[model samples]
Target: MEEFSVRHRRFVANYFAGKVKELRFQLAIVVAGCDKSLSTFTSGGEVSRDNHQAVLYGFSAFTNVIQTLKDAVKTVTNEQLDWSKIERLRHGSFMRNVRNAATHDGNPVISGWADGRYFVPSKIVRIDGFGKTIEIPAPAEDVRAICLDFAEDFCLLLRETLIAAGGIEHLKGSKFSIEEVEDAFANSTFIPPFAKELFAQNREKIEADLKDLKHDPIADAVKELGEVIQYCDSVKGD
Candidate 1:
C-alpha cells in the first residue's frame, strides 16, 4: 500500500470540509419544508416534496463524508477502518441506514404531520454486525437533531483520525488554509489540449476571470453549520 502524503490528506480533508457546508445547506431546506411558518404560503404536497428532497440530499452527503473520512484514515493506517469501532455509531447510526435506503430504493417516507409534528418512516430496520437490531425513530425533527449532533461529532472525529494517520505532524507544520485551497481549486481550469487553439484568443480573459474569483470554504462551512445548529436547538421537544 502507498503511504499517505500531506497533500493527499489535505485534499481529502478539504473536500469533506466543503461537503459539510453543502450538507448543512440541504438540511436547512429540510427544516424550511417542515416549518409551520410556511404553512400559510405552501401547500402540503409542496412542503412534503421539499422535505423529502432535502433529507435525501442531506443524508446522502452525510454518508459521503463518513465514507470519505474512513477511506482517508485507512490510507494512513495499516489496519482496515471499522465502522463498528466508532464510538458515535455504537448507539444507533441512522446516517448509514438513511443513505442506503435513499441510494438503493427511494427516499424514506417523510409524511405524517399532526399537531404540528412530522412523522417519518423507516422501511428497513438496521441490524449490526453483532446481531443487535437498531431502530431509528421516525420523527422528522428528531432525525434532524441527530444529524446535527452526528455532523459535529464526525468533524471532531475526522480531525483526530487524521492526526492519528501520520498527518498530525504535517498538520502542525502546515500553512495551508481552507480558503486558500478552495481558491486554488476555483481558479484551476481544465481546458482540453485539443480545444487550446480554438479558445486561444480568450485564454487571457479566462485566466484573469479565474484569478478574480474568491472562495472561502471554511467561512461558508461555519455559517451553514451555525444555521443548522440554531434551527435544531430552536425546535421545542415534541
Candidate 2:
C-alpha cells in the first residue's frame, strides 16, 4: 500500500495546513475587530477601549490555542512518547489569567491624558493583603507578545507531535529509514499505484518468507522445486 500511504500522507498534510490557515485567519479577525471597536473612543476614552480589546483578544486567542493543542494531542499513534512533557495543557487556567491581568481588570489601563499612539497597559495591576490595588504602568506590548508567543508554540508542538508518531522503527536494526520500505514499493515489477499498496498489504507475509529464505536457503529452494514439479505434473495430466 505504498501508493495508499503516499496519498494518505498528502491528504493529511493538506488537511492540517488548511486548518492552520483557518485558525490564523480567525485570530487575525479577532484582533482586527477589537482594534476597530477601540478606534471610536476619543483620547482618554481610547485608553480603556484599547485595553479592553487587547485583553479580550489575548484571552480568546490563548483559549483557542489551548483547545487546538488538546485536539492535536489526540491524533498521534505512538504510545511510548510522553505527550505531557511537550503538551501545553499543563498551563491551566493560569495562562488565561495572565492574559486577563495583562489585558483587563483595570490593571492594563492607566489613568492619564490620551496619547495618539495605541497602547497596551501592562503594569498597574497588583493587589496586596491590605486589599489595595496598584498600577505598574507597564507596556501593553509585553502582554500581547506573550500571548502571541504561546500561540506560535502551540502551532509548532502540534505539528512536531504528529510527525513523530509516524516513525518507522521497524527498520531500526537494518540501518534503514522508511526509505527501504518505500523502495519496496518502487520496484517496477510491482506495478504502479497498486504496486506499493499491494506490498504494504502483504508485507508481513513477504517479510516472513524473506526471513525463512535467508536462514534456510536449501529448504526454501527445495520447496520451490517441489512446487514446480507439482505444477508440471498437474499440467501434463490435464
Candidate 3:
C-alpha cells in the first residue's frame, strides 16, 4: 500500500480548512434563518410556511456541515468520526433526530405557549429514530443556541483532531504567486481555454484582485469560533 505523503496530508488539511470556512458561512445562514422564523412568529403569532421552510433549510445545512466535517476528518486522519464523542452530542443525537423529523418526516409541529405577557413558539419535532421524541423550545432561539454550542465544540474538536493528524501548516499558506494561481486557473477544466485567454488578457486586473484578496484561514476559524461562543453565552444568559 502506498503511504500517504506529506503533500497528500497537506492537501487533506487544505480540504479541511475549506470545509471549515464553508461551515462558518452555513452557520451564518442558520442564524439568519432562525432569526427570520422568530421574527415572523412574533409578528404573525405563527411562523408561516415560507419562514418555517427557512428554519428547515438551516437545519438541513447544519446536518450537511456535520457530514462534511466527518468526511474531512476521515479523509485526513483515516479515522472514522465518533459523533458520540462530540460533547454536544454525548447526551443525545438531538441535532440529527430533529433534522430527520423536521425535513424527512412531515412538517414539524410548531406550537406556542404563553410566557407571562409574551407568547413563545415551541417547535415540537417527533421521530421514532433514536428511540425518543425531541421537543425544541422557542426554536428560533433554542435551535440557534443548540447549533451555536455544537459549532463551537465541534470546531474545537476539529482543531484538536487536525493538529494531532498533523499541524495545519498549509492553512497558513494562503498566499500564492500570481503565476501559480494563473497556472491553476488555466489548467482547471471548469475554466474554458477561451476564459483562460480572457484571464490572461486581464492579467493586471486578476493580479490586483488576488492582491486585494486577504484571507487567513486560522484567523477566520478563530473569529467564527469566538462568535459561536459569544452567541451561545448570550443565549444561556437569556
Estimate every model's Cα lDDT from 0 to 1. 0.51, 0.43, 0.59
Model 3 gets an lDDT of 0.59
Best by lDDT: 3
Instruction: State residue 44's C-alpha deviation in candidate 2, in Å.
Output: 8.3
Candidate 3 TM-score versus the reference:
0.56
Alpha-carbon error at 7 in model 1, in Å? Answer: 4.1
Candidate 3, after superposition: displacement of residue 6 in Å?
3.6
Candidate 2 wrongly placed segments (more than 4 Å): 1-18, 30-58, 78-141, 167-238
Q: What is the TM-score of each candidate against the true structure?
A: 0.53, 0.35, 0.56
lDDT of 3 by residue, 1-238 (tens): 2345645544554555566767767766656666666565667666556655555565566666777677667655666667667635521355545545555565443233232111226555465656677664443435566677677677767666655654444445435657877889877999878888888899998788766765555454455545555655565443
lDDT of 1 by residue, 145-196 (tens): 5555665555555445544554233333223544454455455577555555
Over the full model, what C-alpha lDDT does candidate 1 score relative to the true structure? 0.51
Off by over 4 Å in 3: 1-5, 43-46, 77-80, 87-92, 96-142, 163-223, 234-238
